[model samples]
Target chain A: MTQEAYRNRVKAAAPKSPLGKNIVMAFLFGGGICTVGQAFLNWYLSMGLPQKSASSYTSMTMVFLGALLTALHVYDRLAKHGGAGTLVPITGFANAVASPAMEFRAEGVVLGMSAKMFIIAGPVIVCGTLASIFCGLCYFVVR
Target chain B: MQTLFIKTPVTVEAHAAVVGKKEGEGPLRDCFDLVAEDIFFGENTFEKAESKFVSQAINLTLKKAGLKPDAIDLLFGGDLLNQCIGTSYGIRSFEIPFLGLYGACSTMAESLALASVTLSCGQISRAIAVTSSHYYSAERQYRFPIEYGGQRPPTAQWTVSGSGAVLLKNGGRGVRVTSVTIGKMLDFGITDANNMGPAMAPAFVDTLKTHLKDTHRKVSDYDLILSGDLGSFGMEMARELAKDEGIFLGENYADCGCLMFDLKRQDVHAGGSGCGCSATVFCGAILPELESGKYRRVLLISTGALMSPTAIQQGESICGIAHAVCFEGE
Candidate 1:
């Protein structure tokens, strides 16, 4: 079958997911994640930590939570129901790394788990670092 | 030339199936030989767990027939994983002469066809055909990370975590493998990996058409006609295609993937799709019904989408194949 014909038939036959429902669920779930981070930030502030330190601690805690959830296989369920909500946070990065490591663990330590850990998140890290470097250079030139 | 049916008949002496927790809770719970809640199955990794499933299935199947691994002349098996490692690693401990096959989700039928043909030709006294699929392992290899919180489209199917093995003897009181129709590669140029049912439906129709022609049989000749892993969407599409060919597949037609799980409750959008989908259903559910003489003649057509991550990445369209195995019960 030609690509056009297949695509037409597939589009007609594919199941239709409710976009409005998914959007609402995503909003609620994403907001819930952000609210949890806010709570962590507030808790750290109440303990007299500096704002900078508190923010960093909040991110660290969320990342840890993400990794833990992935290990326990709970994040997958959340992702299924929550959709982009689970992915639009620092937790998603942790999951992206941890999931590959867990999957490739069978291939042995060096080549499997360790090497492929960055398969998903490697591009994010490289681009993030590069953009930051470019901004830093711009700041120096302006100064 | 690619589509043909078996001539001489072979016998299925014994068969066994092992499934994961989720599958065990489904409608066909009693059909499975072993159902464990844990995906690990007392192993460290999901890969190991899958391998154990295959190994245990083979052993139990042999034991059910009162035969040892040494009694089997050859073992034919495969899995959804790359390199067909789930099958290779699983059967390695038994030290049986192995020939690994890869037909993605259609592996069960592929292996069964080969084993039946080999036995029918009198080349082997006994042969074992086995295949397995694990949800976790298949997910990581085919899609995103297990924890990636992306919403799957309704077309996507749940990969079943299960294994099935069948022991075929030269002759037995069990179901007789009457014929097999081997499929040719048919590419519908489907690119979406998530919707495999639509991609594979054409292949199923193609093989079914050829099988009917070669065997000089009509759809009504068989008591039941089954398809592997077409799920709900593909199953419907196949019927539509068959109707266009002036052959209507009525209620007797069922897709194993659609029957493997409860779609609404299981959250499997289209249905179940994996190597184990048809494998488990055939060994666990279908074979027993045949033994009970509830059905005299049955046709099993297993469909598979042949695509790799590399192939998809290279922008290649997904191709499909289906193998049809006909069985007659005494």
Candidate 2:
């Protein structure tokens, strides 16, 4: 049942639905999310950012924004609908990181969520950033 | 189809693996290659466990059955994917003609039934029916992992990811698939992928009734009857549903799901749900007993809940598939 897994559930809950509205709410929330992403992308572009820079800015803005919302449990509330919509984008990763942290939120910032929250995502970020940087450096060296 | 008797099953093999933090509990699952430490060590373990399982199963089954490489005519098998990449991909390494098949958990039985009929019809002298699955592959592709600890409702039946093979050939002093009863999976519009037991129960009942009717055998005719991975809940539901159909599968009836996990220990909540779940038990435990002539007759009902995440999200009822293979000793 980890946030990382989107499907197979071994210790799954008793079969039942959370009901009608939860599904519809997914679309409503998903549209709002994309609209926010668009707004951020526009704002970054308006500030005279280059295309790649604006893209990175938008991606980061959405991820961070998703992280904040996920921390607040708002994205989880919206996950029932967008199917993978809300969860597939950067927000899903944030939710993956934040939900676990939020669960241990009461345990405090250091030992609880902050430590274990990024257990799944922390290395992903580190390795990804490091890999990208490494590739860039390799290109410069070859050039 | 007419009857063609085969002695020993040509092949039998099994493997299981656990990824991330989940404990590998089942007797067979416990023996799997643990990916937790490897993933921890930055190993692209990926299908290592599953691939190992396929190789081990083929090797074991071939060894136990005393079959040479060239003896196997055609291999029939499949998995959870629409294209059945799992079985086909792993089987690519083995140089054998294969016809991929899928009936979900019932795949083993379906393949067996087809092979039985094929032998009966004298199309080929021998054939191997292999089916497999893995928790990690299934989880990565199908549902959430334990790391996320996502909340799942009861309706979902865990997708079983294990493989099992049954070899059928000419005469021997072993158990032969005497007859087969095939059931069409029916979806009653229940869309909850989590609680697949209930969605699949009706299919079990319908097929059981069909088998008994076709064979003209009573419930007591067979010494033992095992359903593929219907799990504990489906076992209960099948019993109840059978009562309505004037059949009672009580004393000797068992399920792969119930046997796969100690619900109390892992709090598995349900029972084991995977292709290998039922296939392993059928080939490993049940087939051995059948070979020993412990029972003059046995009925193996492999069950399957054919539901995917897309189906559930689309709000579609689940379909259940079951294939009954009658094992009779000479």
Candidate 3:
């Protein structure tokens, strides 16, 4: 078959997703995850932590919860339903690191899991650190 | 089109199926030879566990056929692993002349076709065709880890964590391997790794058309026209494509993947897939039906998507292939 004809056929036969429905799902599920984080932050504040510390502790809790859910095989279900909502959070980072580590764990702890654990998240971490350093340098120069 | 039929018939003397605990709980639970309580089968990793399935399947089939390792002239098998290491590592200790094959999920059909051809030539008296696939092992190799908690789309198929083997001889009293139609690779330019059913449907229909044309057979000729592991969506697409070619598959068509698991209860969205998808089903469900004279003549077409993580990463389209083997019994 000709490439052009084949491409046209595939386009016709392939199923299309509803963008409107997907956006609504993303908003609901994404908002749901953030609401849980907010509740955690409130709980930490009520337990005597300062506002800033409570916010930091909430992030930590969310990351821990993400990794735990990933380990329990629950987060994939959330991400599947919520799409980018689950992906655009600290929890996504936790899943990113935990996923590869668990996969490579069969290879061993030191070389397999430990070395390849940061494969997906390493770039984000490196870039985030470098961007913060650049911001700090800009502040110093302005001062 | 050239005839893909064998001149002399090959015989499937015996067969064996070894599945995981999850498969044991499925609809065909009682059909398998042994269902390992542990998915690992006493292996350290899921990879090794998969290898163990291949070895045990071969051993069990050989035993059922009442033959020793030396009685078999050749061992042809493969798996969904890189380099087909699962097949190699499993059959290594047996000292059999091994031909490691890779047709992805279509490997079992590929092996059977080659084995039958070799036997019909009168050179090899006996050959063993086997293939295996493991869920966790394939996931880690092709996708992310099971721990990733990634939600599977409805089109995604659950890879069967099992192994199946058939001992084929020159002539026997069991199911007769009448002929095999080798498949051609067809690329539809589909790039999505998750949706393989649509990508493979065209190739499957192409093979079915050619097989019918070459053999002068119709959809009604066989008791069943079985596709390997096209799952639910792919099977539907194949039927639609076949209908377009003026070949109505109708009630005679079924997919091993679709029949292997209960879609609703088992949580297998698109149905069971993988090399074991067809292999275990053939040895477990189909072969038994043939033996009981339920399906006198059946055409088994195993379909495969020939794409790797590297190829998909390089933005290459997935190509699909389907190999057909005719099994007849009195």
Candidate 4:
């Protein structure tokens, strides 16, 4: 059979991911994570911290929780069920940075763990930086 | 003819399978010779643990055959690791003449076929074929880190963390290697690395068709037709493709991936995969069934995807190959 014919067959035969269920789970879980962050921010603000400092502390706390869950190997399990829920949160970024560090730790400290620490998050950082610089240039030219 | 009919009787003397904690909880849990509670198998790293799994399987097979490692004239093995390091390190302490293979998931069938051919040539007296794959090692190499909170699609298959070893002798009273049909690489334009079932189904169908044609045998000639690691989706594709060619794959047809786990209970999305999937399933389950006269004649076609992470990223379609080995009961 031609490759095109086979591709069509594969498209038909392949089982699709449950988009409806996944969206529901992602919304609920993602919202729940954000709610927790908001709760942390509220707690900090109640302690007389400024709004910006409260927000920064909340993000740090969420990242710390993400890294902790990843170390405990609970984040991956949650991500499996949560889909984008665990990933869109700061916890997901923490997992993206921490997982490879733990996985490649056996290779050595420098080349293995340290080097591979950003294997996944590296692309995000690079792209984000480049985009930010481009936006900054656009803003300066517009002004 | 692509198929080689072995004139000299080459029989499977002994075989053993060792699986990890997750696989031990599978449906075929009791079939395995050893189910390690520790995923590391007492090793420091997952890679080393995979090598240890291969070693344990070889040791168990040797003990079952009541022969020392020196008695084996040649050893054929491989795995999914880079440079086939899993086999190299796993079998290093044996001090046996080794031939490392890299047929991807089809390494078991490739090694077995080569070992059978060598033994049938009357030069080698005894040979062993072994292969292994670890979930963590394969994941880190092919997909992502273990703790990465990324969701896998439904088509994704769980790599079996296990190893299987089989001892073959020149002539013995057991299941004998009857013939083999080596396959050609076929690419069907499948680029999704996560969906290996369809990517490899064409190769399985091609090899099965070639084997049947060259051997002048019909599908009904064999009691069972088994494909390695095609999972449910790939098996359906194979059956459909075979039907298009006017070949019927009936109730006797099964895939090692589908049989490796309980699909509903096990949470293995598509099923079990990797080199160890077919190897462990054959050694732990099918061989025993064959020995007990449950199956008179069986055909095993192990299919493999030949695409690397680099090739996939470069927008190349996955190429698949399969090797068919026919075994008959005495």
Clash pairs, candidate 1, are: none
User: Which CAPRI quality tier does the interface of model 2 achieve?
Assistant: incorrect
**lDDT scores of the candidates, listed in order:** 0.89, 0.66, 0.88, 0.93
TM-score, candidate number 2? 0.66
Off by over 4 Å in 3: A1-29, A46-50, A77-85, A123-143
Candidate 4 residue lDDT tens string, B108-209: 899999999999999889999999999989999999999999888888999999999999999878999999999999999999999998999999999999
| Candidates, DockQ | 0.60, 0.08, 0.49, 0.93
Off by over 4 Å in 4: none
TM-score of chain B of 4: 0.99
Query: For residues B1-330, could you state the per-residue lDDT of candidate 3 as single tens digits?
Result: 433567676888899999998899999999999898887889888989999999999999989978889999999999999989888999999999989999988899899999998888998899999999999899888887676645566777889999999999997677898878889998988887777877778878988898898888899999999998888888877887798899998898999888889998998888889998899999999899999999999998999999999999998999999888889996
lDDT of 2 by residue, A63-127 (tens): 89777876565665556445555755677787778666755554478896577777667878899
True contact recovery of candidate 4: 0.97
User: In terms of DockQ, which candidate is strongest?
Assistant: 4
Who wins the lDDT comparison? 4
Candidate 2: tens digits of C-alpha lDDT, residues B25-122: 45445444432343222323334455555555666667765776577788777766547776777677778888888787788888888777766666
TM-score of chain B of each: 0.98, 0.86, 0.98, 0.99
Q: Estimate each model's TM-score.
A: 0.93, 0.66, 0.91, 0.99
Q: Where is the poorest 10-residue window by lDDT in model 3 chain A?
A: A9-18
Taking the tens digit of each residue's C-alpha lDDT, what string does model 1 give over A23-56? 8888988899899999999999999999999999
Top-TM-score candidate index: 4
For model 2, what TM-score does chain A reach? 0.57
Q: State the DockQ, from 0 to 1, for candidate 4.
A: 0.93
Model 3, B158: alpha-carbon shift in Å?
1.3
